[model samples]
Target: MKPLVILLAAAAAFGADPPAREKLPTSRADLENGEKLYQANCGLCHGTKGDGGRGAVLAGRKLSRAADDAALVKVIEEGVRGTEMPGAWQLSARESRQVAAFVRSLSRVSSKPVPGDPSRGAELYARNHCSACHTIRGLGGSAGPDLSDTGLRRNPAFLRTSLTDPEAELPRSYQLVSIRSNSGSTITGARLSEDSFSIQVGDSSGKVHSFWKHEISELKKERGKSAMPSYKQLSSADLDDLVAYLSSLKEAS
Candidate 1:
C-alpha cells in the first residue's frame, strides 16, 4: 500500500488526527501552558482574567453555550455557528483540551464582591423600564439579549460598562437596522434575522416585518450603535446598586 494510504489506515484504527475531544489536561505544566494560550488568544475579548469584555465572561458563572469540558473544546475548535465567537482553528486537539480545562478552572477563581444593594437595584431596573427591552428570568422583551444569565455570563464591571456605554460593545445580533421597501415605506427596528434572500425586522411594538431582497430599496445596518440608551446619568450609588442587581441574575434555565 502507498505510504499515505498506510497513514490513513493507522489514523482510522486509532482516532482522527486532532480528534474532536481531548482528555481534560489537569497537570500543572498543562494548565500553565493553557493559561498562556488563553491569555494570548482569548484574553483580549474574554478579559485577561476571564472577567469578560467583548466576549462572555468565563469566570464564576456557568457558561451556557459551552456547558461542559467537551462542549467547550468543540466551541474552541469549531466555534459557535452564528455568534461572534470564531473557532480556534489554530489550536491542536491537545491544546484545545488544555484551554478547555483552564476555562473550567476559571469558574473557581473568587470574584470580587458586588458592592451595593440588589433590592435597590431591582427597583431601579423597574423604575427605568429596563424590562421594556431586556429580559430577566422568563419575563420581559425579546428585542434585547436575554439577561437571564447576564450575571453569570458577565461580571459586574462588564454590566456597568454595558449600562454606561452600550454602544461600546453593541452585540451584532441586536443592532438596530433600518429597511425601506420599494413602496416608499420605511421600518426601523431590531433585525430579527437576515439571509441571502429575505430579512426580518421587529418593530418596537413587537410587530415583525419581512421583506425580500428585491423588495428592499434600502437596507442599512447601524453598526456600533444600540437602540438602548445609556444609563450614565444614573447616580454613582444607583449605578453600583444596578450593577449589583444585574450581577445577581445567574439563572439561565
Candidate 2:
C-alpha cells in the first residue's frame, strides 16, 4: 500500500477528537464562572439573587421556555423571539453553557411531595365556591388573580402561606381597595390597575368599578389586605386536598 493510504487507514482506526458531549465541563469551577457571568450580564434584570425584578423570576419557579440544560444553553446563546430577553452576544459558547448550568442550579425541587388527592381536591374546590372570585383555567371569576399557572410560579410553601394568611404578601395589583362614592355607597374590591387620575377595581361581585379621582369622595388603598378570605377554618385534610389540587394546576395542563 502507498504511504498516504497507510496514513489514511491509521487515521480511520482512531478518532481525532473526543465526542461533543464529552467536551462539556461540569465542575464547581464552571458553575462559579457561570455565576459570575450571570451576575454581570443577567442580574440587573433577573435580580441579584434571581428572585426577579424587571425580568421574570428565575429562582424557585418553573421555566417553560428552557426546561433543561441544553434548551437553556440555546436560549442564552439565542434570545427568545418577540421578547425583551436579549441573546448573550458577549459570551462564548463555553460561557453560555456555564450560564445554563448556573441557571439550572436555581431550580428548587420540593422535598415534601404534594400530600393530598387531586381528584378530591377538585371536588372540594368546587364545594368551597372558589370560582366566585378566583379563576382557574379561565373557568372562574376575574375578580382575583388567575391561578391557571399557579403551580408553575409558586411553590408548595408559598401556596400554603397564601391559603392560611391571604394578606401576608400583597402584590400591587391585588391590594384591597375601599372606595366610597359621593352617594355614600361603598364598594370594596381588589385593585387591578391605577394611574394618577383613575383607578380600576374588581369588586367582590366580579364587577369592575372604574372611578376617577374627582368622582369618589374617599379612596382607600389598604396594603396587606386581600379580598380572598383565609381558609384556616377548613379541616386540615380538606385544606391539604385543596392545596394539592391547586398545585397540580400548570399552564400546559
Candidate 3:
C-alpha cells in the first residue's frame, strides 16, 4: 500500500483516544489537529517542524529516550527527567497523544547533516584534555557534568554555543562559590551541596572540601560563570569537529 494509505489507517486506529501500546495512525483530521497543536505548543524550542532550536533535533534520527509510539507519548506527557523538557501539564492524555504523533512524524523529515567527522572529533576531545574536567563513559573527572550521554541530552547548537560562550546557559546546578573563613582565607570551587550547618565544595584540583558555616565568614554563590574556558579561538573546522564528537556521545544501542 501507499504511504498515504498507511497513514490514514493509523489515524482511523487512533479514533479519539487509543491505548499507549497501539501504534500511531493519522487520519486527515487527526494530522491537521496534531500539527496545529504541535506548532502552537512545541514550536518555541522544538521548532514548528521539529527541526529543533534549543531542544534535541527530532528529524531523521533514532530517538534514544523515545523508542516507540508509546514511549513518545509517555515522554510527551511525563517529560524527560533531569533535562529542560517539561511535561505537558496543560495538555490531557489525548492532546499529548496528538503532539506525540506529530513529533514522531517529524522523524521522516530531512535533518541537516551533522557538521564534522566523529572520529576526528574524538581525537580532538582527548587532545584538548576535555576529560580533565568532564566525565565521559565513567572514565573521566567529575568537576563538570558527566557527559557520557551528552548526545542524547543536548543538540549540536547548544554544544557549539557552550563551547564558544561558556557563560551562556550554564547548568542550573552550576554553582561556583567563594567561601571566606574566619581567618580571612578563601576557597573557591563548585558547590557540591549545602545544608543549614555546612556545605561541600569541589576545588579546582577535584578535591572535595567540607566546611562548617560557623567557620565561614562569608559564602558567595557565583552565577553565569563557568569554570569551563571558552573555545572561541579554535578554528571553525576544529570547533565543528569538537561539536560533532560531543554530539556523537549517545547511549549504547
Candidate 4:
C-alpha cells in the first residue's frame, strides 16, 4: 500500500501525461523562416514581401486548396519547369516546410478589407501598370488574360503565387511560343489564336502579331508557361495590399 501511494504521487508530479508532448507547430516557425528565406532568395523578382514588381503579387489569391503540405513540398522540391521559378532543390525538407508556412500566411492576413481605402486599390491597379497587360472589366490591354471576374475564378493563395511567379502555374490556353525567324530574330509571345496556316500572338509590349505558321522556320511552344513577369521584388506588406485589392475586384454586388 505504501509503494502504491508513492507511485501515484510520482505520476501526479510528472504533470498529467507529460503535457501532451507539446504538439508540433503546423510549420509555423517554418513559415516565419520561410518569410525570411523568401526575402533573401526570391525577393528580387517576387518582391521583398509579395507585391508585384517585375513579377506578380501573390498575397491574396487562392491557387489550389486541394494541394496539401505534401503537394506544396513537391512543388518546392521539383520547381515548375518551363517558367522563371527556377527549381529550388537547394532547400531541405524543413526549409520547404517553412516556405509553405509563409505562403499560407499571406491569405490569412489579406483576408480582411483595407479600411478607408476601397478606391486606393483601384488607383494602385492603374499606377502599378497592371492594366498594361491584364484586362479588368473590359478595360486595359489584350496582352494578358481578362481579370474582369478574377475574384471568382482564383483563390488568394493562387493569386499570390501567380504574382510572385507568373510562369509557375499557367493556364492551358496561354502557352508560350518561341519563334526563331530566318533573320535570326527570336519572337516570344503568348498564343492568342493559332491554326495550321496562321497564328496570332500577344507580346509583352501589349502588341499582337499575326504570323504565318508555315513561314516560321523554327517554332517552339512551351505548354503550361506564361509570358508574364515575376514580381519578386516587392515587400511582403505591399504584396499583401495588392493581393487584397485584386481579390476585392468581384462582380458588382
Which candidate wins on lDDT? 1
lDDT of 1 by residue, 1-253 (tens): 6999999899897875665544698999999999999999988889888887767788876778876677888898998777678899999888888888899899788667889999999999999988876778878876677888788667777789899988877677877988889999999888878899999887765566789999999999887777777999999999999999998887865
Q: All candidates' lDDT scores?
A: 0.84, 0.77, 0.79, 0.67
Candidate 3 has its poorest 10 consecutive residues by lDDT at 16-25
Residue 38 lDDT in candidate 2: 94
lDDT score, residue 175, model 4?
79
lDDT of 4 by residue, 65-153 (tens): 21455665566667656545665778876776677667656645554343323356677667778877788877787777787756544
Q: How accurate locally is residue 54 in candidate 3, as Cα lDDT from 0 to 100?
A: 61
TM-score of 3: 0.80
Model 2 per-residue lDDT tens digits across residues 62-137: 6788766667777888887755688999999999888877877765632246898889998998887878788887
RMSD of 2: 9.9
Identify the runs in model 1 with alpha carbons over 4 angstroms from their true place.
1-23, 61-72, 181-185, 204-207, 211-216
In model 3, which runs have C-alpha deviations exceeding 4 angstroms?
1-20, 23-25, 47-54
Off by over 4 Å in 4: 1-118, 182-184
**Model 2: CA > 4 A from native:** 1-25, 32-62, 67-99, 105-112
Q: What is the TM-score of each candidate against the true structure?
A: 0.78, 0.67, 0.80, 0.51
**Among all windows of ten consecutive residues in candidate 1, which has the lowest summed lDDT?**
14-23
Higher-lDDT candidate of 1 and 4? 1
Most accurate candidate by TM-score: 3
